[model samples]
Target: MRYAQVFYISIYLLAVSFKDVLCIVDPVSLSIGAGVGLGALYGFNFMKDQTYCRVTECCNERSIPGNIGNLRDMLQKRLYGQHIVKQQLISALEAHFNPRISSRKPLVMSFHGTPGTGKNFVAEMIAEALYEKGTKSRFVHKYMGRLDFSVEKNVHIYNQRIYRDVVEGITECPRSLFIFDEVDKMPPGVFESLASLVDYNALPNKLDGSKAIFIFLSNLAGVQISDQLAKMLKNGELRENIKLSAFEQILEKASYNLDGGLKKAGLIEQHVIDHYIPFLPLEKKHVYQCTSAEFMKWERYPHKQVIEAMLQEVITYDRAHGLFSTSGCKTIEKKVATEVWIEKQSV
Candidate 1:
């Protein structure tokens, strides 16, 4: 009885208090008009939400990968021969997104590897896995040194442009991703100004920058990586057992001790980078696996003989002492397409 009285009393108050709607517009309908108008507004908001792409504090699960599973599957099935990359990259992403774990700054990582060794490929995979539109997303920024930073002499210009774009991007969307390809080609200090922005500091509007992600790709330590890989292979150790420590020499060399290295630019000195992932040189077998994956991508079964024939024309072991693909799996897709065309014609 008392609950009924309270509920009725609250309804009465609401009905009376909505004078703006009751008295101004529908003076005659006081009891139910307030509710009618309010309910209409609620319906409008619901419809608006359905129609518009509103960004909430959290990412839209429909657009972004809900967990690390998507990335894990993509890497496991697609990225061959780089077990370390698959393991560490997934782990790093998990920790970064885990609320239980606290990161002081944006998740900054540098990819060091030999050319065609899947550095850019891994970066592309990350973008595709993380963003709804992959590399086409407005929130994902990819910069090539030769093109974006063409005027290397004007390093300051590049810095300002980067700063402006990153700040604008962060303001527009906190979950933005920045990829700088061929970091070695850029002037060492090209990104020095961004160090503070990527650190554990409040952004321009007091926004937390920790949700952002930055990836740097380069072949800076290719030689050192290859040398360590060779040593590991020579010692009969599983390449998967090679730890990040194995690439310490490469890091040291690229870490700014020498001029023109990114470390000299402040990322390493300021402790912004979270990891230096090394993409080991792919063996002939790994290349074969890459070729098979490419064939499957084209909806063709990868017969061993067919793939070897395709590789014979384009495979150039003339470089890197025949240890790895001349260009990793970079050109595998094109080569496969050509072979498929020729084979189809012959058939």
Candidate 2:
């Protein structure tokens, strides 16, 4: 409603400026009418071509590996804080549409987490689940990392439109899950355009009155730092009585560990920590520590047994070479050494 009013006012101003040249009369009425007309057109056009699923389930049942129950279970177990997160996501999607039995609603979900924390895998599992639910929906999208861009050419090679198309493709399916993997990779220049899709009023998707929920999976940790840290730095210093907590180091390391080693080179000012949303460092295990076995298995399979044998070898290596901590050895185990040993063997 506010946007419509603003739109008309802008039109009126432009009309008034050119009124003498164009010889227009009743410019205010014309502008107001046009604004309403456009808004109605946008809404009606969206409704006329609006897409919906013919069934409550996806079409490709045989080809999709898992069932809805399995997918739900996987989501519950794998995604930490599963119950509330799942409900919140579902409710958010549901609010956009009517409660119908037919499955044609397109679901767009964004999952955000740290690097190597299984964002892609979770997407795949969700796709498989939606497929089993009897919708023709599949995990049709893919990863587009920084390497995809051509810096010298200066060409804006973007995949967001491609992702948008993938969602549009499943209009006939019951529940389509369009997963934009590593969404944070969308270039800084294109962020505003992307933001439009997320913002309710500015949505570029006027078509289909899309029942599809847009899932944007990102590493929230990354977003939080990039969006926040700097503004908090202007303050003088931490108070003498206040303690400098480990949360500062965690944010610092997280920023540093991002791709391209850019974050690693950047320094976090102490004043920012003192003034901003500072608290305790998360005492959680590192991603690599939790998924060491998974990484090792993915790397070499049965040879992983032999690699497991190298736990002592690598701990000794770390301690002797000052490569890592003795305590870190417990978390990394032989899996870490196996990764290095395998690389050496390959070389």
Candidate 3:
């Protein structure tokens, strides 16, 4: 509204200058002509302002409505396994979106796990649920750590570029979601550039990002996280008993010990990130569930024997220690596709 008023005044001044130029040629009718011209300009601006407000109001009312229950239901239906991960994410999102919390910072969630454990899958699901176009939305920006910071010598340039891009994104759409995949590959200074946006303190330039969400996906602490979970399971602790808080310290320590940029950038040390959600390594059972889900997606329901045969095609590692998917469910679809093709050929 303030901007509209400023624009109106600027255009009126331009009209006044043109009126003065015309007055020199027709001095006798200057007052009458000036009054009519200015009145018409004012009337046009008033109508424009009203139309702008009406359009903005209609757009706001048409936006998708979301709540905690809707988010949880979507997660449960789309994501398999990682029950704890889903719960923590829901709680964090609920807190971030609560209207009563005025001092809220941008929601920064770090997903630490191996590939194919649904880290990226969960991120995409959240985007789809929150925004109308899902990941395809212009408001949802994705950055690859490796590609953005590939040259170590140009870290300083990349850092500035990252800061500008993020600030501009939030400026355009305050509710934007920024996903950083393979965060472990980012340079130290590059990731640190985003600290200001994530911090609770208001940015110096007044770029309010409290309504935005920043999701970091990394494979840095996967092994240590899995080891901790395995140890808990061996100690007669139920799988459900393991919570994020229980291994928060261990995960932090392992993340810091690693050579990744996450620790080097001081994100964990500074406590800039809100939630550190650990995605436990998927077991054979979970993989089977993933396989089944993929088949269902293709609308092809194979018999149990065929499903078992498809599972056999996916190679697992370290049977002597404890079996886990080599690449998680990342390649399950491709393997399933091949097996399905082979089965059809045999028939």
Give the whole-model CA lDDT for all candidates, comma-separated: 0.76, 0.40, 0.76
- Which candidate, 1 or 2, would have the higher TM-score against the true structure? 1
TM-score of each: 0.81, 0.40, 0.80
Error of 3 at 30 (Å): 28
lDDT of 1 by residue, 200-275 (tens): 7846788777878999888887777777788778889987787877785577566565444384766787777888
| lDDT for each residue of candidate 3 in 1-347, tens digit (9 for 90 to 100) | 66865675677777777777666767666876687668768775565556553443211213323346766887887676687898899989888878888745788888888888899988988887776667886778898888877677787897788788888888867777899898788656667677765787655578788888899898988887777877788889988777888767766776667766576565676788788888888887788888888888777888888778767777575443475676778998887787678768999
Show the lowest summed lDDT stretch of 10 residues, model 1.
50-59
Worst 10 residues of 2 by lDDT: 274-283
Each candidate: RMSD? 9.2, 15.2, 7.3
Q: Report model 3's TM-score to 2 decimal places.
A: 0.80
Task: For model 3, give the 10-residue run with minimal summed lDDT.
Answer: 56-65
lDDT ranking from best to worst? 1, 3, 2
